[model samples]
Target: MKLLFLLFLVINGAHAATHSLKYFYTATSGIPNFPEFVTVGLVDGLPISYYDSKIRRETPRQDWMAETEGPEYWDQQTQVSIGSEQTFKANIDIGKQRFNQSGGVHTVQWMYGCEWDEETGATDGYDQDGYDGEDFISLDLKNLRYIAPVQQAVITKHKWDQNRAQLENRKHYLTQECIDWLKKYVDYGKSTLKRTVLPSVSLLQKSPSSPVTCHATGFYPRSVMVFWRRDGDQVYEDVEHGEVLHNEDGTFQNSVHLTVKPEDLDSGRYECVVQLSGVQEDFVTKLERSVVKTNHGNTGRTNPGAEGSGSSGLIIGAVVAVLLLVAIVCGVVIWKKKKNAKKGFAPANTSDDGSNSSNNTAPKA
Candidate 1:
């Protein structure tokens, strides 16, 4: 599985008010030491709550969510997730039968979410399902039908589409109920969600001839852009943009590498620019040999703002954490199918790295 996450785009302007609420449900079979079912709920790209078969309970991941919600809320959510767990377990069996697989590791995923633009009063909702790391079916809200990408999913699409009541209920939940909950969450966590923390940028390299890497860490909201600029213009060629990773303390980190010739490095015309959400000022780091820290013996100079010699270790740890997540995920036969899908569904070439109440109804597959 090529696990990748582009959680949210960088929302520009100080008054930008776009928020999203998403739920990811994964059910697996034949995975040792791992939960058979897992659920993650994110609001504006930050995990707010989590549930798993091992825990048998839905718990808050964010302090604001825990503090704002009471026991009754969690109890209700736990029950909702419990019901979903049962449905997904059966769904897995159905998927296996459809794929004609008798045994081995397998996974079934359901992604449903909604996005709201507070400033413009626009709302959108999506629901999608995947079997064995491939797109299966998704709900088309406009037409009120199910779209089946692969032939195996045709029966399921027909079955689910015929249930107009369930379709309407899902549509109402996604468009109306989901947005209401998102607004409440945004209100409850406004203090923490609205807060901004500036990033600490650094320049690092392993050798003089190696590419210069610009690393930014300790930022919040998880929406930021890092790029290499040469002579006041953005440099796209020979530049690699790294994924945004979560820090231990809930902040985020990102990196960009620029391969430059020795002569170009000497010119000092290149700089790294970081643009963070809701921030007016841009963080810039000049590309100078003196400012670049290298691991080559004692010739390197450390940036006071950086984590000193341990900076490389921190970067390595972040990358390893991402790899470990990918490694632990249950393996399945990668399916290749193409079909038009809704918001929660990804394209055929890409697979998503894979919930609650009454606003508490169990999801029906």
Candidate 2:
């Protein structure tokens, strides 16, 4: 298996339907004005293969982004990426104008992420707003509660009472739109895209190549089911099911792994099944014992059996934290030294390393 991870079920709790809708908005300006643009992403648990904003249309999407965003023409970029240089420049000018007219901060920022896991559950979300690098407002979507920027204060202390209901209704409206969009996308995928991108299955084994994995990719709707079978019967003991993963092209990939004993490798008895709508027949792949090649890395993003087991996400988060810390420290040191130098004083650590001569006591950049 490329991504070697054993599933450990601490609590076999009932699972809610995996569904999420994320939205991100950003506005900035160099001209002392601010203009805002909004974009939303809809997914039925995971990414889909096609693009249709009207969602119910058998006809293809007509947005400029739709031409290269469909299953057949998509690049690596996902739907979450929706900004452009032309729009960015326009937004900067708009933001500058807004700032000048509104008589406030030089910049404005807004962002929100919303998710609904259970089919019947309420949508939960996080929202933030800022102006001129300072927090303007923040919200917790799950409880419809407001987060005060100051300590020992109720939301009323922030004047939210004046517009809380209206603001909350806006959040609800956004969530409902996402749900509607997701429903249409799911229907479209099952009825249309599912038949377009055929599943390509690969059997992979790591360097020493012991446990073989049946990997499936280029599928849609997030309704795929994959499992391992032995001699025409589903095997439960040595089988592990992966999560539905979002591919770069807005399609999805998944894998189910089986750890076969050395003696069973050559038996040619292991098979994997991938099922989806519009598939008249199931796509099955048999693990070839003689050719179970070494798996160098991940087969795209594999589904981990358990929730919150994102190795890649965690690693990226940690690396980002470290880099941010280093950058902040470097910025502070540079700012302080420059400020002090302007007052005719060198930094305390500006000693010459090679010699202690007075001539060598000149400033160092």
Candidate 3:
């Protein structure tokens, strides 16, 4: 009986502490057609470990690989993600079909980010789908779910009520996996002096925007602090802080934004400071206005191959659409040719239809 109780505690202990589990499943339309990706983030109240579907590798991988039980999840997660990828693609299509009989115009996506905090109980960082600048089939973790075409019977309330349990269970399962992964990593990191990935800070300014951003990336263990200082004292107000996001190679990045008036750019002095856990040293970068290209006009655009938001680049069936378009054009050409045949006129090697092709018999003049 004691052993059984202890086992229960072993499984349930993670929930009793301050932590978060966020599972992101996304499928978006794009070229090169790499659709469908699922990633899980484990936060022991601060970003700690991550599981990316594309690589099937978990961040803080060294500690995970050290565990005998940990390596098993590598193959297990890969297989599970592979299966979810198809389901997510279908999920994306469901939203696209809602707005468009064929599909949406640009890109379409279905995404879910489930994060549970000690204070908030459970919340979705983001739970929605975007189709051609419109959102549909939205689901919030706290029971505030509504579709865009809600009034028009897009999805009956009956079906949605039934599927609620299933969706919640899926979120729960991923959250449990996160708890296990984070607990193991925290333990592993403490067992030894873990090798550190030093922080790199950059002073940048966005295009067409007056905000100056201080970006810090490529650091490990995830217990990083990034802040802006103005000549010694901490500058609090007017500062925009971004979430800590994982890099492709398992490091973390964050950005702190500050807006400066055009005239005040030269007068105010600013610096970016980065501090990583387990490292006695800190990295500080001086903000240089001349070095940052604020007027370059394309700074806000994201890199396609970069670490964040890879979910927005998944592929949809462009080939089928292209084939359909070509078939329509061909049908139009054939119809015109048949009509010309009835008129006792057909021309080979015709370059611009000209007036001759329309009326080959001299226009009855």
Give the candidate order by descending TM-score: 1, 3, 2
Highest lDDT against the true fold, candidate: 1
Measured by TM-score, the strongest candidate is 1
> Per-residue lDDT for 89-206 in model 2, tens only?
3434444453455533344334444445555666555555443444545665555656656342243324443445434554654466545544445444443433345565666776
Instruction: State how far residue 161 of model 3 sits from its true place (Å).
Output: 1.4
Q: What lDDT score belongs to each candidate, Candidate 1 first?
A: 0.69, 0.43, 0.44
TM-score of each: 0.81, 0.41, 0.46
lDDT of 2: 0.43
Off by over 4 Å in 3: 1-19, 29-79, 101-135, 138-157, 163-249, 255-365
> What is the lDDT, from 0 to 100, of the residue 308 in candidate 2?
21
Query: Relative to the unseen true structure, what is the Cα RMSD of model 3?
Result: 21.1
| Inter-residue clash pairs, candidate 3 | none
What would the TM-score be for candidate 3 when compared with the true structure? 0.46
Q: Encode model 1's per-residue lDDT on 65-109: one tens digit a residue.
A: 999888987886777677677777887888888889978988887
